[model samples]
Target: MSFLGLAHCSLPPQAESLRQEVREFLAGALAGRGAAARAQSWDGFDPEFSRSIGARGWIGMTWPRRYGGAERSALERYVVIEEMLAAGAPVSAHWFGDRQTGPLLLRYGTEAQRVSILPAIARGELFFCIGMSEPDAGSDVAAIRSRARRVPGGWELSGAKVWTTNAHRAHSMLGLFRTAPEAAERHAGLSQFLVDMRSPGVSVRPITDMAGREHFNEVRLDQVFVPDSALVGTEGDGWAQVMAELAYERSGPERYLSGVQLLLELVRAAGPAAGERARVAVGRAVASMVTLRQMSLAIAGMLEAGANPAQEAAIVKDLGTAFEQSLPEVVHELLGVEPDRAADTDLGRVHAVLLELAPCFSLRGGTREVLRGIIARGLGLR
Candidate 1:
């Protein structure tokens, strides 16, 4: 039950050098992009942009060279991701694959599966979505009712998943399903599989958010048949595997950088002669950003050292999302400006987009209540 300390973890010189290289690349790549468009943050999707990133060897920076990765340190990957996020690069096309799916395969997939899928993912030619949350079960992943029954040569998957990000555009999904009847143990029967999105019975219905965007989807699987090789790791090991996967999902720069575009606008809107309250709000937000970045970096260091920092990741996500969700309110209060999506100014447009999208920051990786429960259990207070 050891916890991560608040001490800062410094990135290596190579990582810093790579940071500048990423910045230069992003400058040319993201030029002429408006603040409103950039406000999408990691949710922006562009296949061409993702392919370009792959061409630069930035997509799978930490994976082995045999798998089309640069075999760089996790901290170097961190620098590249943070720079892309800050510049609002449209990375959603390869986001899930680079962030979790590729790593999951490296850790749990068969050698053949790795050889076949990892290289395409590293090349940014294949995209993936996570299929965990269902209509009945959102944050409570163990309660998923999707069933995968074994047939002669494959498994038949049936059920529906809600709030699935990128399912409409992704080529595949790393889905969780029930392989056995529920036992006294709540997590015993769950299993994971790699299901191709193009499978005959799979269908995706987009779910529009308050921002009028169709990033989330409801995916229905009606007896979708996946070959036996699609199974990830051993059966009944999905609980542990998915828990590890969540550590990757929750500890990234996207947790804290979601509101950065609006934050930059806030600073611009508040000139040198601003009131004390406005200055104080901006300063407080900056402080939280720096602290969260330090915590996330420490978790990256732990991951590099082969440690599972799930509890620490939960803590960072909870605080980071709270920071993100609060920016719009703070800006509205301090600047006395209402959000205007159709406004011509960058401040109005960015603020409008972020204000509409802020409520989802806490809901994406894991809910706030779920995150706190994880923290409580880790602290032996539950």
Candidate 2:
């Protein structure tokens, strides 16, 4: 089989109807939400709005009905995400739980854990944050020093996690820690635990970004006790599990749609009488978006078929982040206008924020160098 096996994907006819439904809902729901709020894109956090989306049964659309899922196809869920990001809807409150964490729990969590957590996540009443990156270990999951020493009926976790998105607001975290000392082989002795964020000794401090947003956090686990039941999958299996979870992370529409609001505003700012240069730039960005969307949809299809296309996902994520990072610069160049915060307009405010936010786009998920290395390994070039 070819290494870059990107299969064809066509959404079912029902996806169009779902798209229209989401569009209508957004039209009414986001009428005056403003571009500054919309500029946050998928990172926007609104628990009330998330609960509203859950009430619509849009969360966990692909899981079993026994767990509060809609039992819908992954493609159906794909359409909802695409529409939401394109409309700049606030989905951050439930995005991580719905997009990846919930699926991870479904695949690995115990029956009791599922019964207690899955329904609330599906209802958008609960939120989760990833506990992957640490201060000393950004992309290198193997370099993490967080340890969970075995104790009676539980483990005492002690270490800190950095760049933990929404950790301050999350109810729980899927924390990757060392269950045993590092082996000669780098990937051994790793484990993942579902940690309750509100537990004693678990502290979350907000980390402000360049954009002045407090979404990311420093999560400190100072000898926090986690029951053995919170262990996800098997002990010493976290390395493999994290790789699988990242496949879900890297293959979503959110990877590419981060700058879509800026792109939309750019077009509106340009209007119909745009010069040839502006037209060409817009056309190029549109082409990239279409191609990336198709590739992402193909990955979604692979996931639906229970395939682990981690390499392909890395390729898609690398390309998607490139596009996302470049979009703001492209818009700025095309519009030939400075990011104006004082302007009484949505477009200006959006442009201002996106310029500040775009630099971090490639850093999230994984860095370009790390993603490229993953792709190279996938192709057996390393």
* Residue 45 shift from truth in candidate 2, angstroms: 0.9
Backbone clashes, candidate 1: 0
Give the TM-scores of the predictions, in the order they appear: 0.97, 0.97
lDDT of 2 by residue, 130-218 (tens): 99988899888899999999999999999999999899888999999998898898898999999999999998899999767889999
Tens digits of per-residue lDDT for model 1, 264-324: 9888877788789988998999899999999999989988888888889999999999999
How far off is residue 370 in model 1, in Å?
Answer: 0.8
- Cα deviation at 323, candidate 2, in Å, is 1.1
Predicted structure 2, TM vs. truth: 0.97
lDDT of the candidates, in the order given: 0.90, 0.88
Against the true structure, whose lDDT is highest?
Answer: 1
